[model samples]
Target: MTDIHIQPRPVVHQLRAFTPDLPDRTVGELRRLLGLDEVIKLSFNESPYGPSPRVVAALQQAARYVNFYYDPEGRELRDKLAAHYGVGSDYIFLANGADEAITLIAQAYLAPGDEAVIPALTFGTCAFATRLVGAQPVFVPVRQDLAIDLAAMAQAVTPRTKLVYLCNPNNPTGIMIDGSELRRFVAGLPQHIIVLIDEAYAEFVTDPAYLSGMALMPNHANIVTVRTFSKIYGMAALRLGYGIARPELVAMINRVRNPFNVNFLAHVAALAALADTDFHRLVAARNAEQRQRLTEAFTERGWQVCPSQTNFLFADTGQDSAAFCLALARRGIIIRPGHGWQLPSFVRITVGSPEQNDKLLAALRELNGQ
Candidate 1:
């Protein structure tokens, strides 16, 4: 038999595999290895409180309709979202997740020799997607305080630049860019460049100065905003995310989107979740409370905690983050080590339920011999 061989793209050889915080196999393995009945997970920036009862009920109701494909265009949910934001339905495009939406934007707008501007320490997806599409990702370093340096990013732009990606209440570092600053940044960019902002954690924000990227859409034709139901709605498993842009941009993105990108159950569940504003408020309020508690606890230990408007907290532990995370995992708690993000002494902790938070704090205390 001849050995099978096929030529793959050069970029595929250079790509780094995505490292999820908690793989499913790791969950079971951890339980067995640690002799624990259960393990607490606070690694993925997921909501400690699961999806609203309404989402569950909606999924249950839609279970019988699995035989039929959902609306290929995701019109119902798209229209609902548009109405919610007082935009035309044509302004929205639904994808498997906001991550997919980011990739889709890259696919539709980028090509070889094009360049994308991304923050050095923000969500890895932005850089990953940029590279996946064979475009150069120009990484601009964040400010000393770990906030995005919009001015520096602006200065980095050149004739080759085609896209700019931003993650608000940015992942790992958990610092949000002020709205006014973002407005100026987008406004000053040449009309040829498209600015894609990932606001996956926008719902978790409590800061008054923070602004949604959608607010810039009316004035800036180059603005595209991606949001996900995975965070505050607690629907990570559903993989429902949507993007908002002008009708023309959405149409271009739709060309690369799979017709049935979002499943029926996810569509109905998102619709149900949207209507449950009370549950939304409840989760946001509780997250703020727990976030404050965790901040104080980390500060008490003399660790430097980045001020966060998101559900996760990023802190410099003054120790090896990977080793610290491993120590916590052995004690049946899971968190994200920052080594992958190039912060060897930092870790990103999702604000979990009170009991889960207690477990994490106690594990840290033990590890430090406090």
Candidate 2:
């Protein structure tokens, strides 16, 4: 037989498999092992309050239409989002999730030798997407305060730089850049560079100084704002996210977007979720109260807690995070260890419902012998 060998692109060699920061044991397994009544999961920054009742009703009603193909354009959801963001419907690009939107952006705009400026410790997906398209990901380290160093990121841009990625209220640290600083940074960048801002946690932010990247799209043709329904809307399982940009840029990205990437149920859920604004408002209010309570609790315990405007809190427990998380897991509490982000002293805890928070605090207090 003649030898026939095929090889993947060299960029494939640089890729590493992603391992989620979760406990080895399932919630059920942990409950049995620990003889516990409940296993409180505080990872992934998911909404403690599940989706709105309207979303549930919408999905139940939508279940009947599963036999039919979903709208390829996702026009209904896009129209809802456009009206909410005060943009034309043509400027919206819906994807399976914000993660897919990012990858699609890379596919559309990046080529071999292209460079993407990314924050060193934000979300890993941005870097992964950049590498998927054979582009170099230039990592700019966060500032000492753990904020995205916009100036340093701007300095990293060069003639080959085609994209810049930012994550507000950065994961693992929860630090955000101020609105003025972000505006200044974007304004200073070259007009040709595509600026992609991942605002997955935008809806949870209560800080007045924080600004949505979508607000900047009118003036900056190169700016792309990617948002998700997974966070505040409690649609994580539904997998619906969208990007806002100039109509031209959206059209370009749409070229790479798979047809019917978003399913019918997700569209229905998202539209219903949008109309049920009161539910989100209540969730946000609860999150705000719990977020502050958790912050104070961590601070009172001498743990260094970051001021987070998101649904999760990042804290340095002054111990190995893996060990810390494991200790908590033994008591039927699950959280994300920061070892994956190279910060072994920290952990990310998702703010949960009041009862869940009470249990977590009690467990922590017991662990500390308080």
Candidate 3:
């Protein structure tokens, strides 16, 4: 036995300071541990109605192309998306998911000591990415109504701020600024700051007042709109999403972006999925129906439900959510606990299938002593 062991170098201080904040195990693993016969997951906002049947057929057809390298440019899918938006392909950039786009944005523009502006209690990735880049995240607390406090956010910006993240129909809260307000926000900002709009759940939004940040693109060069096929498209397993920004911005992000980042089958299926308009329509309609039903259900029972445009609901849960979620977990329903993000009296639950939503209601009814 030769003692030829190599020592690993210590991680950087920033890396050491970064803390992980996700559940230890997935729903299925937890289900087995609890000996539950079934689990209704309303944590991650995934489509109850899956991708169009055409997506399945297309993936089967694309099985043969798995041996080949994906298009380095991801041109086909970009072209399809461009056509959908009536924008040029130069404005589009693809990533494994919008998650990767967040990292790419951080990598391209963030330097040590730079700060990112974010809405408090929104998705954690934007803040996480800021810390990853050795930059600081300045969180602007949501208003009393549980919507982003735009005034407070603008006031938080300083000379060191490089980026601002706006999650349209913001995750965990589901409130969004309409087009006019968003336009004003962008117009008022310092010209040098880049705004990254995370629209991961845009497709599920139903409120007519809600607006997609996509409209700002090409018009506002500093704005980057990130979208995904993970939500309404039911293609979470196959990570595929894109960023819409000015061509120069897209080019900057691509510099840090690896060549051929999107895989073969994901590319093939995304293109096919885009073509299935009927399924898209159906999913959107169903989500709207469920979103309304869930909101009313909670409101009738005296719980305050934040007015949501997206496919999930955030409620002032009124107790210790950690223990509450564990109790629901024992009954085989998984929901997101909110206090970890600093909202102790809140919980976020996804708009799931009708049957599953009903199951969750029944469980809550029991626990609520209704």
Candidate 4:
């Protein structure tokens, strides 16, 4: 018999120690745990409306190409995106999702001990992506209005600052930095520091003053504007998103992305979704209606709802948000607790269908015994 030898395991440092522990995406998990057949998930900021019929047809048509590999360059989708945005194909870079794009940006630019400036109340993914690349996240607190404090952000910049992440119609808070304010801030920034402008919810915005980052990208070599099909296009499951930047920056980001990062189905679906203007208008109209309804409902319930330009409302619960989410969950309602973003008294609720919004309002009233 041959003697068996066991190899010693290599000692590895705990990378997780430096990152924040993200709570499980509880809305999906809790639904399964309760064995509920149908869940009104107003927790995640997903479009309540499904993808357009044209998108479904396109996916069905593209199913035959499943046996073949997708285009590594994602040329077709890039062309379509360029036509839609009025930019050259070379200016666009496709990714599996906006989250993937965020990671790619981090990989392309961030280094250990370098700083990435972000608004404290913005999405957690930005922070996670920065830390993943061993970069420090300098969180500049928002103004009393819950908008990004552009002056504070400008001051937050230091010699070590490498990237500035600005989520327009900023997540959780749902407030946007004024266009003039952003322009002045960007103009004043050192050319070495890149600005990552995340406009994931731009389509849902009604404010004329809410500028698209693409408008600023042409002049600023240091700016990258990201958009997602997951929000207005109702294609979160497909996980398609893209970024707009100067061709040079796009090339750098493309080098860092996996060749087949965006799947074949997602490419086809995104093209069709972009073409479905009727569906876009419908979703936008419905979103606006629901946003107003939800805001009124919260106001009537004595909750302070943040002024939102996106398809979600961030309500100050005036109590422990974590506990409030738990109480709402027991009643079969789920909303995102704001503790993850360091706001303990707020909860973010996605704008759902009229029926779903009513249910959420009813649940909130019930929880408060109003």
- Give per-model TM-scores: 0.97, 0.96, 0.93, 0.91
Going through the candidates in the order shown, the clash numbers are 0, 0, 0, 0
Between candidates 2 and 3, the one scoring higher on lDDT is 2
What order do candidates take by TM-score, descending?
1, 2, 3, 4
In order, the Cα lDDT scores of the candidates are 0.90, 0.89, 0.85, 0.86
TM-score of 1: 0.97
The sequence of per-residue lDDT tens digits that candidate 4 reaches over residues 1-370 is 9887865322122133433222244556666765665567777788888899999999999999899998889999899889988999999998888988888999999988899999887887778888777788999988887878999999999999999999998887788778888898899999889899999999999988888778887667899998999999999988888899999999898889999999999998998988899999999999999999989888887889999999999988789988888777776777788877778998889999888888887887787784
Better of 2 and 4 by TM-score: 2
Model 3 lDDT at residue 160: 96
- Candidate 1 wrong stretches, greater than 4 Å: 19-26
RMSD of each: 1.5, 2.1, 2.8, 3.6
Error of 2 at 62 (Å): 1.0
User: Which is better, 3 or 4, measured by TM-score?
Assistant: 3
Off by over 4 Å in 3: 1-24
Model 4 local distance difference test score? 0.86
* Model 2 residue 23 CA deviation in Å: 4.3
Candidate 2 C-alpha lDDT tens digits along 292-362: 99999999989999889999999989989897788898787898888878888988999999999998999
